[model samples]
Target: MAGDTKERILETALALFAQSGYLGTSMHDIAKELGITKGALYKHYASKQEILDSIVERMNKMDYERAEAYEMPETEPDGFAEAYLHTPIAKIRTYSMAQFDHWTKEPFSSNFRKMLTLEQYRDPKLAQLYHDYLATGPTKYMAAIFRKLTDSDDAAMQLALEFYGPMFLLYSVYDGANEKESVAPMLCAHIDRFIAKIESGYRKPHAEGA
Candidate 1:
């Protein structure tokens, strides 16, 4: 079927893109890998850029779906921290592990991540995608959630950094290995410290106070 062929082309292209830099992979390579002629590939994707665009679109949609599924507390500021903290550690761990698996284990996702990582430095669009995916997008979303609790952009951003920073570092070290078991505890520890800081009404000390 036409749909199946298009899907196959996309999957083959993703694998090739991950193995070779986006700039290095060509239409002929994708066509050959898919056991299709260049003209046949054109019927599905007019150009390599079109295929790349499709991949980015699909992955972004997945992210949007995940964000939509995440539930945020509706409690008051005084109770927000406690409510968020009371969420079972097992639930948090499961979410964290799911994210780890998404980036490391899922074939399409893993290849797409690697492709973006490989091409980010060379392409402006890819660079922006990398930043949006790994940093600004999640940070901004969390900042909005935290703002409901703190009512301060600075405080919200600080909390987002404290919470997501360790997880970002963990992603770098995670290679679909035993790193998950080793890092889950550290991730939970960071969460524990972050919650403790929030409960303590943490504030930056002035030079004079110091």
Candidate 2:
């Protein structure tokens, strides 16, 4: 029963936070929504910030794991480009896209999205964590993968950005509130286009061991 209560509370809070901005929500709201006493809610989560922080932490851990799974192999092709195109980096794209879809489709996805937008201006600390995960961490990871695949000092980083950039932009514009079908095709098309671009960029010019 205690376990069920904890899960219920978290689920309810997640939905609430994603639907309404953190500032707009109160502990009382959560308690009222859950049909529980404020003290019972407090027992589950000490504060709203604490609950939000926990959700963000879980998201961070999932992202790190997602990226880590794409670690490039050591014996990859001379530039690492082949391995990247053939293996880990490809997997990363698939993984990220799936994660995006999951978040967008989940019951609390709206709340999650809402919290993401709200946190940037409402809390610097939360924003920093997001910056680290979405911007800094993924950018660095993609850059490394690109470096390996293209054999260019900065080409890899640029390629990584180019490849995944649209997915972010598309999500930013749509935000999953509506037009699910209109946005879905483009989300994948952008990835496919980037893959082709990367392949063209990485092809060896004038072969024979120059």
Candidate 3:
């Protein structure tokens, strides 16, 4: 029950944070929404910031779990691109699309992303988190995966942008979507085309030692 309460507190805090900017939402609001007293909430979370930290931790854990489940390569001493080199493009595409679905669909991840987006402008701390989670962090991760395939850092980073930019744009479209179906097909088409492009234009030659 103690563990359950802690989970509940994080979930409730995240939902409230998404709906109301993190700064706008208060401890009282989370406790009230949970139908609990402030004192009870504090028993589980000493502070709202602590609750947010737990939420971020869970989000990171889920990200790696989802990546593993999809068989996406993880960074190694050599590089993730090296790991991805032997992996199937279809599997990579599956992992990429799964991450897309996760951020846009899964309640916890979706709420966390939305909370970061909403609160980013209101707090410098959250703004950095917004960039870390949604922007620079993902770009850097993808760039690392592209590094060995490209001739230079600029080229790798550019490829990362080219690969990820479309899906990045789609998040907002999906969020505003009346039906999720409207956005899913676009994502599907994108993954297919981009995978084909990478195979023909990039990875094949690399495989041949070009």
Candidate 4:
């Protein structure tokens, strides 16, 4: 029974937080929506900050799981690198866009956007989660390919960003955009060009070097 209550509270809180944000939502709002007293709400969550913490924890776990499935070989030669860059680029982007689309259509969508926008101020720790995850995980893997393909560290980093930066940006933008006409194809094309550019840099100089 206690576990069930916690689940209900979390589900309600996630929905409300995604709609109104931490500041906009009150304990009374949660209690009233749940048809319970403020005291009952406190039994589950001490405060709004605690709720934010829980939400961030859940989001992080979801992100980590998604990234785990998409992991790539960090250091590989041209053949594997090219294949790595091509296959998952489109599929992952499209999957991410679909999730965003689903969320935007929900009543909590506006609040969710506001929380994402204002969350930096409210919880600095949560703000850095996405960057930290990308830098250490997915982006790190791609960076290895970039370094192998381009002798210059700056060039490699730039190339990796060219592929990932837009992917991240498009997921945020396309969540609310039209679904029938999506941005995934265009983003894939741009990434493909980036891959081709990386491949060009890896070619050995023939008589020009000799």
Better of 2 and 4 by lDDT: 2
Give RMSD (Å) of candidate 2 vs. truth. 4.4
Top of the candidates by lDDT: 3
- Candidate 1 backbone collisions, by pair: none
Write down the lDDT of every candidate, Cα atoms only: 0.73, 0.67, 0.87, 0.60
Give one digit per residue, the lDDT tens place, for model 4 in 1-210: 988897677668767766676567788998898999999889888997787677667656655554456553323455555555454545545544544443344433334444665554676664564345433444665576656456677877777777777766665576566662567676657666765564455533321353
lDDT of 2 by residue, 52-135 (tens): 777777666755564466563444334544455556446756865775675565565445655666666787875775566446
Off by over 4 Å in 1: 67-93, 176-181, 192-210
- Candidate 3 structure quality by residue, lDDT tens digits, 1-210: 899989988888898889987888999999999999999888888998888889989988997888788877676725777877888877887888888988988989999999989988889999999999899888887888888878898988998898888989999999988897789889989889878888898889888983
Please give the TM-score that candidate 3 achieves against the real structure: 0.95
> Who is ahead in lDDT, 2 or 3?
3
List all candidate RMSDs to the true structure: 6.3, 4.4, 1.4, 6.0
Candidate ranking (lDDT, best to worst): 3, 1, 2, 4
Q: Which 10-residue window of candidate 1 scores lowest in summed lDDT?
A: 201-210
Superposed model 3: Cα runs more than 4 Å off: none
